[model samples]
Target: MKKIVILFILFYSAVFAQSKFPVDSSYTVKSVYDKVKKAHPYISYVPARNYKTVKEEKEIVYKKIKDRELHLDAYFNQTKKRNPAIVIVHGGGWRSGNKSQMETFAIEMASKEYSCFNIEFRLSLEAPYPAGIFDVKNAIQYIKKNARKFNVDTTKIAVLGCSSGAQMASLIGTTNGKIAFEEPNSDKKFSSKVNAIVNIDGTLAFKHPESIEGTVAGLWLGGSYAEVPQIWEQAAPLNQTDKNTPPILFINSSVPRFHAGRDDMIAILNKYGIYNEVHTIENSPHSFWFLNPWFDETIVYTTQFLDKIFK
Candidate 1:
């Protein structure tokens, strides 16, 4: 009797969990847009106002090499044929951030005939440095492995992110086709790579003299410049750029420290004969470009660049 009771309890829990995120066609694009607006209240425009779910796994499960149970949310647009894809990485100083922050962007991309995904990676304090990069690589591989099912053009996929996510995005853009930090092959034979990148106010170098005292470098990298110099070098996206890497779009603000040395990165790309673009906002706060009219301009410029390259 106790065994039967236990089984029934497990069954009910599963059902409850499933019921919480029930899929409903009645959940219109406008409604989803409304939810996004309610949450952000800052984004100025909504592009992908509608999407037909090509694929969705609300609580898709993944077990890391470390045996960590990672939950990922994924959605794909079925409405488009052979669409380009964009994977979004969110930012929270590498210690905190979720996949949800990219939902509106994902939905908008889907609406615009581009398959999109918002990814969640392990956090810094929660996990560590290479873990986040590992998770992102895994996500890219997962998408490529399921490309046909999602109607995503694996060859044309782009990565975009903000803050730490921007660091990851730049990492992908600069390191595509390079296996600098690849894990022991747990799944497939190929490396995960992106064709383009959109990075927003992301830190590129941990070697900055300012990073010596106290800044994100100390917190996320787990030590001061003197303490973990090699770790900083290894974590820097600036260390990863090459010729075969994707074309890049850099979005920076007028804020001090944050936008510093981005031009240096562009210089490195130019030295390597790589294609890149920089769009700097005139006298704005760090990531404040995410607010009101600024967001609209940012999105417009970004999407316009995407359009130019995608075609």
Candidate 2:
């Protein structure tokens, strides 16, 4: 009787653990940061390192229309054989940020044998609504067109973005081959489809009741949900899901505001039988990708997700 009771207890414990959320549910931004800092004092204080081993090619023009020149930075391990690739977009509330913001993460990914492209897209200051979307789509098309030059496996490409960039990455992943978002001058011959996506605490829906006026999404989208309902609906990634949507992995911060509408997006994904995962970093800020401890954790889940889909 004693042996049976112990066995049952152990079995129940294992099952409960397995069924729990994939992320650390207990950690919050402040607590996790404090804990990590206590152990590694320099974890959040260290400057971004430009991995010396990874070869980097900067400012390669990916799109040229009229006088406007959009460029992207590429990083990779020198090899003749084709390898999986990822295009990373930076986030700054849709109005700021550049390719440099993604340099550290891209370099680390390149060191891991993935061809990484840190891309530049038009910001709200330069263009609004679908302009950034078109720029990102063009970047993917450019990468696909130059796959041989970069030794990138055309079929095994993924996109990763943080903040507003995550919104863009999610959009690109969900609306692949959708004609409505395609740019006029983009090389449409090469499909802009990606195999997977990684969204780091980005907004997924602009029409969420929580999305108010003066917010990043509202401003970048050129109006509030009530003012331009059509545009809001059109810009939302959650509404764009279909059976063909690629697998997505969301690495989020502890802030509930950052994950608004994520549950609804996941529901749509499930309804379509699409693969998706959400892993939250407890007690971490929305910008956790730039800090340590959380940064390493981000890479682990990212690499795991990409590997699973690419395989």
Candidate 3:
């Protein structure tokens, strides 16, 4: 009896620990800052400042799936006219990180007359691939359903993602109209399609010549390149690119590996005559969007691209 009880205890403990492989708190703006501060000492945390003209609302529940409740922060200017909306997705290798990292972008974009949402989704630590994808896509449906209240211009919706989030954003944006990626619970009246995408320092392909992805990425993606070649290709924006893909803005850092398959994706986009843009921040480190100078610089490019497409 004693031996059986001990075995059960061990099994329960192992299961509990496995369920939280990557603790969300383990990754934060401060943590990322600490890791890169030594290499780029000049970089500093981007302070959050409301435009004052824009209203900020946090923790708005967007979706409830089983035990998981997803939420987002909304920043919008009180206006009589409908405004463009941008759904912002944060990055932590898809394992850790939260919507709060995008608070600054939401606030600033709101001040610029854009209804911006900093959205949260289950990370790989909780629910692996496609689950997070569906969460974000469904959040878009929720945003569209409440478009009138938020003064959103449904025709002008966009998505902006950083690192792994960017990879997902590209996947979601390009896969628009594909029934294969649709979630049954998503709003039937509205689809999870966007007019534009902004990818920040994210890979276009996990299996490309310039890709450095290995164990760290493979963990979230289910397996290594060799173990799951088809899955890797399936997730790549390069593979999903079609003539229907929306206009994209690539705000890349100096790292080349992160830009893997980007040029190829661009080639396809150009073939279809779809609008696309790329701007690499010289000497900037990965995740530079969290730092000053670059943070503001990113907003500039973002708003500019948005205006070109939606304004």
Q: Residue 44's C-alpha lDDT in candidate 1?
A: 54
Question: On residues 1-311, what C-alpha lDDT tens digit does candidate 2 reach at each position?
Answer: 99999999999899777542222223233444676576457666325666655788899998876667889999987887888999998887787777876787888888877999999887776677898888888888898899988879999999999988898898898898888888877776899999998999988877566543256677778877778889888877888877888989999988776666789888888988889998998877667887776888998899889888875
lDDT, residue 220, candidate 1: 67
Ranking by TM-score: 3, 2, 1
Model 1: per-residue Cα lDDT over 1-311, one tens digit each: 99999999999998777542222232233443455465456555433344456455555654355445555566677664777888888876676657765676666566666777787777755656777787887887887777787788887888888877888788777776566666556366545778889988887776664233256546667787688888878777777776776788888776546644577778888988877888887755555434555666677767877877786
TM-score of each: 0.78, 0.83, 0.91
Model 1 weakest 10-residue run by lDDT? 20-29
Ranking by lDDT: 3, 2, 1
Residue 27, candidate 1: C-alpha displacement in angstroms: 28
Best by lDDT: 3
Model 2, C-alpha of 27: deviation from truth (Å) = 26
* Runs with alpha carbons beyond 4 Å of true place in candidate 3: 1-22
Lowest summed lDDT window (length 10), candidate 2: 20-29
Tens-place lDDT digits, model 3, residues 135-237: 8899899899999888899999999999999999999899998887888767789878899999988999998889988876787778888988888888888
